[model samples]
Target: MIPAAAWGYQISSYPGTGGIWLRRAAVPHTGVVMPDDTDPANGPTSGSASSEAQRRTELGAFLRLRRERTTPEDAGISRGTRRRTPGLRREEVAQLSGVGVAWYTWLEQGRRINPSVQVLDAIARTLRLDRTERDHLYRLADIPGVPLDVSATQPQPPEHQTILDALIPLPATIVTARYDVLAFNDAYAALDPGLALLPAADRNVLWHLFTAEEHLQPLVEWEREVSFMVAQLRAESGRRLGDPHWTGFIRQFSETNGRFAEIWARHEVASSVTRRKSFWTVDGDEISVIATGFAMASTPDTKMWIYTPDDARSQRLLGLLVGRYQELGPAELLRRGARTGGAGRSSAH
Candidate 1:
């Protein structure tokens, strides 16, 4: 007899009016041994099989939790007064994710079924999973080659922010593996005043370069810089294949930017290296600087990029710009500098 606690069910008897009593109990087969030819070392042990089963159960529960928290209105479905569920129903999830109701039901029931990455992506999007939650979903689905750290968008440390601030005269920024601007010094912000004023979501270097015309206009050799940046991103993509944030950014960027899509299709790849970049300032002055990157100690995946003026003239211009920023503040300086054509520069090596 199976233990009631182990099976999670109880046996009970019902008494009949005719003086007969009936007892019923359901016992599920909980064990299945592997074939004799199975390799002992490589094959799943009974313990391993049980663990996998538990993981499936947990995965189902997690899906249910996320689904229950997602309201119909959040999924763009019209809410009805007679709705009974707290959030989205199973059918609603299936419909929104473009999957069949029965298949999704089996998945939610913890039945063993292989889910493709594409299907999982659709489900994740429908659930509106954040980076961490998306990573958890991929792992629970048994996807291979998962990123070592999926929570790549976590806030930058305070010390890192302070370090950025310390690099006041020289333009500096701390960026994630995906080139998201985690922190930037005032000098860096002054270099591109428009970028500094953008929303946090649009602050990423790659996103700004590809999507914003103003970002590209200041670069001396726009095509060359864009190509190299794309190549660098392509190289990083190999290590970040299954990362939701990385993948989502690439997809959205490609869809929105025709040039990015064209460049990405070439499949070019390059490693990051110190280089000289030049920028044409609003004042029609050409400033050259050397740009270099250093890995942050607190976050290995993040790097600090500093742009130092290469020539005496460029250095003096940068110092002048910094002084103006200190005196007038970021917004006021940007306004006055633009009006006066006072500052604009680039890095060269």
Candidate 2:
């Protein structure tokens, strides 16, 4: 699950992370996140101290304001009658959020420290933040929040499926800048049959290209197409340099595929472009396509890629492929699609 605030996901109030949340190892001690001011990357790093510093300071103040306004009764807690300050104390917020005073102090003080998504969600809930306020808090922190529940995020509209299906013979699919395949037509499924077999998370073009899935084939200009994909991904990665999910995708691919790691290390960059592309099927058949894209206005950084048959042979093949899909139907196709072990071995297993 990813942050809902940025990706149309509703804020989740899950009390636990459900899986392994932290990296490395967990320390059985309080004040686990020791403050380090020397690390330039510790706090926001936009060059403008006024802007970044102000954002962090505002974030701290915002948390403080919420804490001060909410009474102990609202938080379902009480500290006998000796309390001097109004609302819950700094220590109380930390304790309620399952964090330490020292760590939360730095967070509240706008110090250089990164808070985990779970911790932020906990804090937001403790402060009784609404969806809009949660979004604001994440924005102030310069962090894209992930919803604890996958369902917290919205799904593609029913009309999108109809739009995809209407493309008929033309192989078309909607994908994010990250090449995450959101929706596809029957022709697309026919052209790249392996796509429908994978789980939702593995429904990525990059994953399909490198994995044991037979999605990749002999191309017209050798491996230039794949190289272009890598370059394009690198170019778009600038939008989310420290994003966990984006970084994890790169890390997993780099760890698993040597060629991918090598290409990624080049730092080459490219953008999406219309071009004539050719692909060879496992059956030794070739299909040429004129690939064009249409931006989806409703979904940010998402576009529809349409592959039109460029040659007579391709046109015939595409028609045959669509017919094949129709004959098998969705139910039969799904029944035949078996799940594979994804990009890498999950840490959980």
**Which candidate gets the maximum lDDT versus the true structure?**
1
Q: How close to the true structure is residue 292 of candidate 2, measured as C-alpha lDDT? A: 97
- Candidate 1: where are CA atoms >4 Å away? 1-38, 41-154, 213-216, 341-349
How does model 2 score by TM-score? Answer: 0.61
Model 2 agreement with the true structure over 179-255: per-residue lDDT tens digits: 78888888887766666656666787776776643323235444677789999999887766655667877898999
Model 1 clash pairs are 276-349, 277-347, 279-346, 281-344, 289-347, 289-348
Model 2 superposed RMSD (Cα): 12.4
lDDT accuracy of residue 348 in candidate 1: 20
- Worst ten-residue run, lDDT, model 1? 22-31
Every candidate's lDDT: 0.70, 0.69
Q: Relative to the unseen true structure, what is the C-alpha lDDT of residue 346 in candidate 1, on a scale of 0 to 100?
A: 41
Cα displacement (angstroms), candidate 2, residue 151, comes to 11
lDDT (Cα, tens digit) per residue for candidate 1, span 1-349: 7554433211132112243321221211211221222234775456777666666677889899999999888899988899887899887897888876555655666655556666787898899997678778877867653443423255666888787888888899888777777778878776665567777655777677666545224567668988998999898887756666568878998898888899999999998899998766545466678989998765646689999999999888777766766676656765665676534434321
Q: How many residue pairs clash in all the candidates, one count each?
A: 6, 5
